[model samples]
Target: MFLALKEVGQSKIRYTLISLIMIAILFLVFFITGLANGLSFADSSSLQNLKTDYIVTNEEADGAVINSTLSEDQLKTIEEQLNQQSTPFSLTISAVEDKQGKEVNVAYFSVDTEKYSDIEIIEGKNISELTGNEVIINENIKNHGYELNDIIVDKISDTPMKIAGFSKNQTYTFLPVIYADFDLGMSNIYGDEPSYNAVLYTGEKVDISGFDTLTKNEAVKSIPGYTETQGSLMMMVVFLFIISAFVSTVFFFIITIQKLNQFGILKAVGADTKYIAKSIFIQVILLTTIGLSLSGLAIYGITQLLPGEMPFKISPTLMLGTAGLFLVLNLLGSLLSVYKVAKIDALEAIGRVE
Candidate 1:
């Protein structure tokens, strides 16, 4: 360990460059993972906030909440069969005009607020207090200059909906959501027969004949583009991690080769191969630790500077797990060099071979 530190101090520039490279690679991995998580959350925060065990959708809809259409009879049948309370809801994305007449895409959610009790109100009254023309919006809309008591016009019917309150972290498919009461007026707007997109229920198992039951996670995946987006970002993260390992292996291999003669001299003077290997291990550990720490800090600083609209979330647990994987891969990559050091012939490395 002492010798490894001495060498790193003597070769400050070279090690600094290597450390910088490691930092950059790890930063990209961390940032990409964070973005992937953020996108997933943004895509499904509305559903997640429901805190229900199962979402009942029409089987024909193929697990898509938006595409599912459940009639009053179907909802009642399921409720009767499962013997649990079910909240019928509808979700749609449409352009709505802000007070300034600027159109913005927002997800409109129609539900019986009294029955659906999982919503978290961050700054205003519960959804039950909202009238047909009154709505509760996600706080993210505040970024667009909308506030409590602001009037937003539904583009479809030109109905002015008042923002009665704000909810925290309720977004669907990356768009801010507005929760409105499923009154007779809103039901007429959707359809005359009173159909809902899906039903939210909490139960162990649902045996509805015509409807499909999905867990919360499954419902999230049913959102369009959610699965594909996450898959692509995760693939990139995996490839980057592989590349980092490869780079570390090559760099350490070259460093080990250059130090062959030094290892030979130490061995000739009474140092064992284990001692030499320990030094290499120490150097790899120090380098990886310093690089990952800096990368984490850099990610934190960058996220702080980003605009609120950008979907980027950093999970401490996920970051720590990623860092641990990176450290293990780096150490494994350096082992090739350690193997080389273990096989070093003192005489041959010192040019005493005849």
Candidate 2:
């Protein structure tokens, strides 16, 4: 450790340049990771916010809520069979016209108010208190110029509803969510048919014939484009890791080659191969720590500057996990330089082999 510090102190410029490269690489990795998480949350915040452990969808729908349909009778049977408290809700992706006649895309969540009054109202009255054609909307809809008591008309049904409240993080499939009463919404949207897309249960899994039970994770995966988007972003993160490893290996290997004569002299003076290898490992760890710390600060600043609508989120767990993984990869990469140092012949390195 002492030798490594001394070397870095003597070659501050070179070490600083290497650290800068690492910082840039780590910052990009962290930024992309945050975006991946943010997009996921924005796409399914409504479902993610639910405390339920599992969801029931029609077997024919193959676990996808959008494709599933359950009548009031089927929901009662499932409730009796499972003997658990459940929430029934229906979803539809459609557009509603604001008071100004401007169309705004929305994900309508028609829920049974008595059974599921979990939609938190950040402003105005709760959905349960709403009577007549009143709906609660996601706070994000405020970006589109809607406010409490504003009137929005359903383009399809020509039914006008008043915005009763605003809720936070209530989005579905990247669209702002609007919560409505089940009886009123189903009658208007589905022509007097009392049906729901799925049922949310708050207990262990139980198999019910003709219906498919999906865990939270399974249901999340079933969201359209969710798997594909996450896979692509994750692939980019993996590639960045590979690039960081390659950069670390080459940088340290070159440095080791440049200092062979000095290493030979040290070995002759009783400095062992283990000491030299430890120096390389210590250098890698030090540089990685500095890079990761700076990258974290940089990401925090960037998130602050980003707009609220931008899908960018940061979690401490992700940051720490990424930093730990980066440190490990860099250590593994430095092994090549360590191996080269171990193979050095003290006599030949000092030009005394002849």
Candidate 3:
């Protein structure tokens, strides 16, 4: 163990270079991990914000928010059974026109003002005061140069919804979510009964035996391409993990091979294989630990510099999981060198036969 670390210290330049390479890979993996989480959150944040135990939507939409439509009668029956805060739901064409009248696509949420607890109004007035076509927009809307009291015009067949408030973290399908009163939103989107396609049920137990009750996650899956979107992002995360593992392993193996003469000398001096292997393992672990520690600090620094709307989130569990995976792969990589050390003949040192 002492010799391995000492050798690294002596060849500080090489070790530093290797650690930097590992650090770069770690940064990339962590970045991709953040992106995957961002994508997942964007798909489901609106449903999560509903603060409901269960989310019931159209099974036909296949987990898509825009595709599902449920009758108000279907909604009323569920509320009577589950004691829910039912809101008539429909998605409007998401066109947000900034102060300059330039447009960006977004997701519009039409919810109940009376049951506004299901959603929060961070800036400006609540739904109760919303009247005369007033509509509340998401924080993402505000970030795009629209501010309080800004007029929001939907570039569709329907009338424009007035922007009354700025909101927080309401996103779906990677688009920001804007909220409006059910009466106003439904009339604009559907124009009558069954106008609202899905129902957001807030309760402990939802009895959908007569009908189907889909949780928020299930509701999301009901949207076509929802799960596939998440699955693809996860595939990228897994790819980054593989890259991190293979790169670290190969580097360690090569370094060990280069140190063969030192291992042979130690073996001739009666060093135990167990002790030698342990040292190699210790060296690999130490190197990885230092690299991760630096990367952890770097991630924090980088996320701080990111724009608020960027889908970058920090999760300790994910960071720990990624680090642990690298640690195991690094140790596994040292196995080849450990085996090579074990086979070194002590007789080679003296050139003598027993």
Candidate 4:
């Protein structure tokens, strides 16, 4: 270990370049991990945080909330039979105008507002005040210059709007969320008769009998690209790492061959093959550690720069997995050099001089 660091310190420039390769590979691994998490969150934010066990939507819709609609009356029917509180899934509705004259696509959820416990008010009145004209938005939009009492204009029926308050960071289908009264929620999207996209079952699984009810995990898969996108990205992440391990192995093998005479001298002087192997392996671990640590910081900075819709999430478990993968890969790379070391001829270094 001491000699390895000593070698690194002496020719730091050359070693820096070698270490850079490790850094670049680790950076890519972490970056893809971030993308995987981000895309999943972006794809499932609608139902991920809901305090419900399952969602009830029209079976024909095949789990798509944005395209499905159920009448509020249907919601009432489901509620009456409930063992616990259920929420009407008021999703869909696009191209809303803020009274301030800006236009954006939005997802509006119509809850009884007074019923759910997770829908916290971070900056405005409780959802009970969300009426036909009053609306609640997320901090993400509010940070975009929209403030309390400001009107958001909507081209759909030229809906009149007022920011009654702001809520914590709750999002749906990757869009910044806007919560409103059930009547306003429907009027904003349907323009008339109000309805919900689905119903959320919170207690002892409201018996839908003939209707379909999906657990929270099952519901997110209905979001377009939710499963396939994550599956594809995850595949790419694995493929990239396999390539990296091979590349590192090849590079280390070449470096080992060039140092054969030196290794032979050490071996001839009583150093065992185990010592050489251990030294080579330690170098691999050190190189990968440096790369991955640097990339972790870089990925975090990049995540902060992205919008809420960008599904790049940071999970502690994932970081640990990434670190573990890097270490294993580098160990595999170092092991490849052992074959070359085993072939070194101790006699060659004795009197052979260039």
Top TM-score prediction, candidate number: 1
Assess candidate 4 and give its lDDT: 0.73
Q: Candidate 3, 132: how far from true, in Å?
A: 5.1
- Over 8-126, each residue of candidate 1 has an lDDT whose tens digit, in order, gives 99999999999999999999999999998899899899988875788888899899898888777887887778787778888867778665668788888888878877478888778
All candidates' TM-scores? 0.96, 0.92, 0.86, 0.85
lDDT per residue as tens, model 2, 63-155: 678888888799888888889778887888778876567888888888767777566679987866878878888998887788899888877
Write the candidate numbers in order of decreasing TM-score.
Answer: 1, 2, 3, 4
C-alpha lDDT (0 to 100) for residue 258 of candidate 4: 73
lDDT tens readout by residue for model 3, 127-174: 667776787666777667877886667666346676787767688776
Residue 172 lDDT in model 2? 84
The CA lDDT at 112 in model 1 is 84
In model 4, how large is the Cα lDDT of residue 112?
A: 62
Which stretches of candidate 1 lie above 4 Å from their native place?
187-190
lDDT-best of 1 and 4: 1
